[model samples]
Target chain A: MKRKPSIVVVASSGGHLTQAMCATSLVKRDLVLVSNKNMLDGSHFTRVYTIRDTQYNVLIHAVNFFVALKILLKERPRAMFSTGGPICLPFALAAKITRTRFVFLDTMSRVTELSNSGKIIKKYGLYDSFLCQWEAVANDSGAEYHGQAFDLGDHGHQ
Target chain B: MVKPLILVTMGTNDYPFTRLYNAIKNDSLYTDNRCEWFIQTGSCEAPVAPACGVIEKIIPRADMEDLIRRSALVISHCGIGTLNLMLKYRKRVIFVPRVAAHDEFSDDHQLQIAREIKNQRMKVVFPDDQFPLLDYEQIKEDNKLSDPVDITNYDLAEIINQKLTG
Candidate 1:
């Protein structure tokens, strides 16, 4: 049997996961989710890997780095993507070290600026492609803006 | 016949959103048995349960989706997940963004996103603003709605797809 290459998506459970799913809806490659919480029902991703979630915890990030490396080694994905809530920080580091193409989409929740994890990844030059959902935010940060993950326009109340 | 359902979600983050819970408790509809309420409180504690409904910490994603489908109006934290669902289902929504001042979240990102919200069906209640009184007529009106069009921005998804696959 042959193993298919996958695109590993990193995001937290709430809005980050929603944006990631919306943003990656067009991807034809096998989608594998690397989320901090396993809230998903496996309807979307080929596989789901849970990792310790953190924004400011240094030790957890360090541990998740190895977990990321292990998953990358096993999957050897075609690329990596994230709509971050800081849980993707270690995965970003691992993607750079493993030479996997990494695309980071700043979460739509941060309307005014890049998210904290996005700022860290951007500052460290860890991503292959960077995008922001907000046009003004993208303009300010130099990230690609291709509109939001979903339409905010009302559809006349169902 | 089932009563009109109101779903209140505070997201899955570990913040205690007592402010939202308190506001709902103080509302006139809190003790109304004609309507049903399911409040997913996350870490927020509810000392006084609703007279007619229940409060829970968290629920499965599928359960939440079902609740959203049945809900006439959704009182939600300004989390994008709930916003996406409300928009997808075209539910009447009251968005109360979690603010940093009250330790509802680590930062004011929810408020930031709340300000950018321009959806006619959705209303954003700022920290200074009071949670609007639950409107029974609108809830009953919304309960009649059926399916809504899918609103995912595939244009953005296509760009993202190209960035990853190209």
Candidate 2:
């Protein structure tokens, strides 16, 4: 049997997590999800890991980084996907070191400026493919704009 | 007198009105007796009310859907959830983007969403811009406005399936 590509979806709580979940419906492979405490529940993931809600602190970030490394080691995911925020940082680094494909889907917001998370990812150039919601943002950030994957016109309940 | 209930939400994270709450309260626009204003403070500290026509209600996140449904008009921050709810319910929305200058966030995604709303011909309010606070009659007029897009017709699962598998 052909081996399926393993994927890990990472994000912070709330909108970023929601956007990640919405995007994950497209992947047809083994998946593991990691997010902050707030998004741990009411999610569809075979394996879920919760991290502390640390927006921008080095101490909290270091802990999350190690935790992510541990998870990545155990899961052996072929690709990592994240919407944005601090949680994605460690995984993106691990993906680079492990030669795993890191796909950073810039969250769909803020047309004028790149998100802080997007800026960090761009600075490190860790993303194998940086997906964006709008072409203008992608062009400005020098990332690949995949356009909005979410069917915003669709209001059907999930 | 029966007054139309105006629902205002500034989203889950961004609270641009936190500092401006006091300024708004003192303004005659909010203090004038015309309609009842019901504001939802997602996670921010509640604003002190000025003696006027406004009534503040701090709603938990769980109650957002119910309140949106019952409201005659929704004045909300430019968040995906807020936009989705307004689109889904086909409700009249006067959206205001949260600005970074207000310490809302490090970036300005809300402003982008607001721009998109305006492009769609939907009613929206920009932050730092003056707005004639909607009265009961205006709220009704706003609801009668049509949104250019019908979000219900598109299939989200199909889109996701195509993107992931192909």
Candidate 3:
């Protein structure tokens, strides 16, 4: 049987990881999930990799950049999909350099504006396509206004 | 089950949300009403008193999900992750936000999210707001449990499906 195209699903821990999982659960093909250590329960994915959490440290961030690059090189996935976060940036960049298509899904928290991560992706044209959960964010950031990642279980919690 | 499990989580945010932790710890109702308490304290130091099951570090996703599934009520810091999980499980939630003034969070975004949760099925509890914790008799008298709100099934999933497939 022919191998299905795999998309790399990447994010930071907590909300970013959760949003990525919820959104990527929709993908029909295989998925390669990556995030910071213990940030996700990856039993659902065929492959899962954990990167260390280094949000503010410049040196560690640089090291993890290569770590992300390594993962992308190994996976060579068809597409890289991410919910915006610091950790996902490296993978997105590696994917960009490799000419792998990248999709950036802005998390639902930034209702009125684009998050810091989202802005960086939009400003640099890092993603092949950028999607926003809220229409206002899409309007302000010029990312395409896709529906929210949280709507499947939004439960009016906002 | 000796008592309904009331799970309290401050999320896995590195900063300890002492406000939520203290609120539940000091409140007499959770114990007085015989609600067995389990708290995922994360980085927050668990209370020495009130003797509850505590998780001080990040837990695996499945373990977290199982706790949520078993809980009768969930009291949480207004994290999108915790809220999303509660919504997915359709559990009754008491949403509490870490406040900037209290130095609980770097920003007041959680407060904004908590306000929105007020319009939903969950009850929003602000730091200074006077809410009687676990007034079981009053809840039963008011018959509040019968109406189940379907807060899931918004258009986000469809949009993602379309974006990926089409």
Candidate 4:
């Protein structure tokens, strides 16, 4: 029996999470989501885990690392996708050790310099593909442009 | 007759323009009791003077749409979130980019966004090193100079959808 590839989507709250959700709709595989914010309400996930919001404090990062390690062992996802933030750190590190494919999408906010998170993950060489919203960011980061970068769009009243 | 209200948002990220808050708190421009100021701070600790003639309220993560709907002018940081919200709402806006040297961020990318907005002839403000005190009336008048470019979310959705499906 051919097993469907397992996929894990991870991001911080707000824009990153929103961007990841956009990608989730197109993925037709076993899916899991991990985030630091309670932004996920009524989300479709095989499992959902909340990690400490890493906007402040390093202790949260240490805790999330262990949590990610445990999740990696249990699900053994084939690929990991992230929109760049502290929450993606643990998963990126775990993917490196497990030899799983890791994809990093630099947020649209950075048109020139790599985001702080992007810079940190760049050294790992674990990222199989680095996706960027702007061509300049891809050129500057030395990552192959994945193309078709999306901006969050004009704010529409819900 | 009531004056049109002006909404000011600095977004969730704290910028180094704390001085702007202090400058407008007790300014004579707001003393006329004609112009109303609706300001949202990124932090609860933002030092705000008591309401003199204009109303001041501290809203933590308030709805951007509500703020824009009730406002005639929007003063905001050069962040994309705020910029997109203003454009989405079709409100006349003035943007002030935070300087990187002031520790606003690790880089000065906001300046790049600001330049892009300027190239489009959108209303934007880039403070000189001196952080010159701005006249509210002048800022309000400058907003009428340009027509905002229509940047829609449909394009964004289509692009992401293609990437994910492809």
The numbered model that scores best in lDDT is 1
Task: State the lDDT of candidate 4 residue by residue for B1-166, as single tens digits.
Answer: 4455666766544344564465455556545455666776654244544343233333422344565666666767777656655654556666777667766654677787677663232456566634334465754543332233435334444444344334
Tens digits of lDDT, candidate 1, A78-102? 9999999888988999999999999
Encode model 4's per-residue lDDT on A1-158: one tens digit a residue: 97766778787655466556555555677768887644344545667777776644678777877888888888788678888677788778888888777778776666667777888888767577776777777787786565433333333322
Q: Considering every candidate listed, which one attains the maximal DockQ?
A: 1
DockQ of candidate 2 relative to the true structure: 0.24
lDDT string for model 3 (B1-166, tens) is 3456677888776788777777787777544545556788877886554544544456777777877877777788888788778777767778888877987766676776666563455888887896446765533332222223434333665566555545
Better of 3 and 4 by TM-score: 3
- Report the error of model 4 at residue A49, Å: 5.6
Model 3 chain A: weakest 10-residue lDDT segment is A149-158
* Candidate 2 structure quality by residue, lDDT tens digits, B28-101: 64654555567766555655643333344344434566666666677766777667667656676667666788
Better by DockQ, candidate 4 or 2: 2
Off by over 4 Å in 1: none
TM-scores, chain B, all models: 0.93, 0.69, 0.76, 0.70
Q: Per-residue CA lDDT of candidate 1, range B19-96, in tens? A: 999999998888988788999998898888887888899887878888988888889999988888888888888999
lDDT of 1 at B134: 88
Q: How good is model 2 by TM-score?
A: 0.73
Whole-model lDDT, model 2: 0.65
Of the two candidates 3 and 4, the one with more favorable lDDT, higher being better, is 3
